[model samples]
Target: MFVTESFNRQLDDLLERICSKLQISSAQHRLAQDRYETIGNWLGARESPLAMFNPVIYPQGSLRIGTTVRPCSGQEYDLDLVCEVQLDWRQVERPVAVLDAVEQRLKKYDTYKTMLERKKRCIRVNYANEFHLDILPACPDPSSGTTCVVVPDRDVRGWKPSNPKGYAAWFESRAKTFEVYLAEHQEPLPSQEPVEMKAPLKRVVQLIKRWRDLKYADDQKIAPISIVLTTLAAEHYGGQQSTSEALAGILAGIVASIPPRNQRLLVLNPKNTKEDLSEKWDENPDAYEAFVSGIIAFHQSWQDIARGRGIPSVSATLRDLFGEDLTKSVVKEQAESIQKARSEQRLHMQKSTGILSGLTTAGSVSVRSNTFYGSQEVLP
Candidate 1:
């Protein structure tokens, strides 16, 4: 509503580009479905509880978009088709073993098993084409607290459910609320309301997103892809946005556009690993080195900006911006001075309380030991 015109066009172009690339031709969808259903059938045949394919989570959206928004273009987050399996409809086991077995079973097919591997929580299968499936092994565990999702050998702490249907419902609810909030706070939507809404929303979204990218990268020291998505929900009403939005926003801004120094943290291009990560970093060492320095410098700049803004959470701000030791130190002389003062006060208090007297006061000479002590001692 109140947004600049250029920002609106950019948003439209981005969404259009993303959606166009994601259009599911019937043939392609059918193939994906065949593979998905085949995997499901395989799991069910294993006497595993009935498996269901969730359509909502398939084409990863804005979160994945954020991953690609970095300066180095080819860094892509995986497109995950998360399959939630009801193993007994009560709890899910370490489906890694199942994934292992499934990969083995599918290996002979050769069409589907080349890149399949059991990652932390899922069976990741790479297709001959660029598309991939992150077949997350899940069983409902009430002990998983409110989320009811569990990953074996991994702490379930701070994890949330990503079921497509459930997440879609949640997102729809949030979108409705966000739309309402926008209408109330901003000018009335244009006759072409949908078109009009696109720009401001896009700019704000991107700006907030850029901020999130920064905070997650620089301050939180979180994984790049993680910061991208988490920052999105924090910046916009993505149904799943939680209480952590404020912190997410702060962290995102702090770490925006950071060139990753750690090779382990780099997300290589899915199609060409060497081209995306190794070769680029190796060839342009000077540029990459400059990029890292720039990130740290920008983080410092954000610290000043945040301080100026009077944002709370000092610990978080400090962690993201730069490394510094804020802990107060106790120098020996200072400790001695403090201890002497405390002993004198203690002696004075004891004298006032009518406790044992004729005492050597702290910081006074001890006759027997011939030593100057900082505490009181009875002369008796």
Candidate 2:
């Protein structure tokens, strides 16, 4: 059943508050950008071999897509960056040499020396209490023009192809199409200014990621990765303007898109067919099942909130989905707002009818047989 207007308003308010809390502060953003720029400048110094290739450093994943969320407790935000150099793959016999060169140069700097560590696919630089930057050194793929690149992977000990720019572009195009559809249908577009203006899609992604974090807090290794969840949600989103509505649609749509347990789900990179986002699902069925269960639980909680149950029940459901601290804060704010409205309505009725005899002490008085004074007044 469709939710009441009052319930929808409350849900929207709670979601807006949650999204605001999930986002990193402006200072955090500036710090991360400055750090990346410093790394880029260092890598592109005239004395460095990478300078000859005219290396270009840019963000690739969540940072580029604008879906970044604040890291959970004891965890640091991850920043994925690509250091693309204009070099001929044919001339470089060993792709790992490229990664090694980048790592070597980064080690030359005293600031980066102790923070840097070699990962399977990237050079990780940890900035304690802030974020970790994963720098993937890559060379352009001649076959794919400028969109695709090949990076060295220590796990496979070979060069792997990726098109992060292309994938991001694809996602942007899908968002635009959904927004246009909403506009044509006379529904509220995600944003009138630009896709980045409202960031409904990004907010929904962040909320889902946070839910995944909470669900698998104990067994993080088995938790669904951000990329997989992001791709699925983006694939299924239909331009929901509000964060909560968009989240519900994404959760239901993604769960329905998943194949049965007997079959392995294939979440291919939209830009590169060779890269499978869900490759881990085949290797670990339990993790995949857990992800599905989490989605179901999220949907159930969403439904409970939509049912227009009393504030206490809805607050409990929200706490079950999002944690006590966030739920309590948001519910308390909503309760206060509701109480304020009732007070204003009671005062207005007292002045209008010049009768305070029937007014109840509960802030809400029955004006007639079934209607309460403040209950019917929908706040703007």
Compute each candidate's TM-score over C-alphas. Answer: 0.40, 0.82
lDDT, candidate 2, residue 146? 54
Query: How many clashing residue pairs, candidate 1?
Result: 17
User: Looking at model 1, which ten-residue stretch has the lowest summed lDDT?
Assistant: 1-10
Compared with the true structure, the alpha-carbon lDDT of candidate 1 equals 0.38
Error of 2 at 365 (Å): 14
Full-model lDDT for every candidate? 0.38, 0.76
Mark the regions of model 1 whose C-alpha exceeds 4 Å error after superposition: 1-77, 88-95, 101-110, 128-131, 145-147, 153-177, 181-223, 227-380
The digit string of per-residue lDDT tens for model 1 on 1-380 reads 11111222222233333222223444655665676677655654534333242211233334322222322122222444444444433233443543444455555555665677666556677765445666654444444233344323233322233333333333344345545666667787468643423222223334333444444453432323332333333334333212123223433443553444454124332222221222334545554454455445544654454443211223244334322221011112322433454445422223333322224455343222223533332211
Residue 222 in candidate 2, Cα distance off native in Å: 1.0
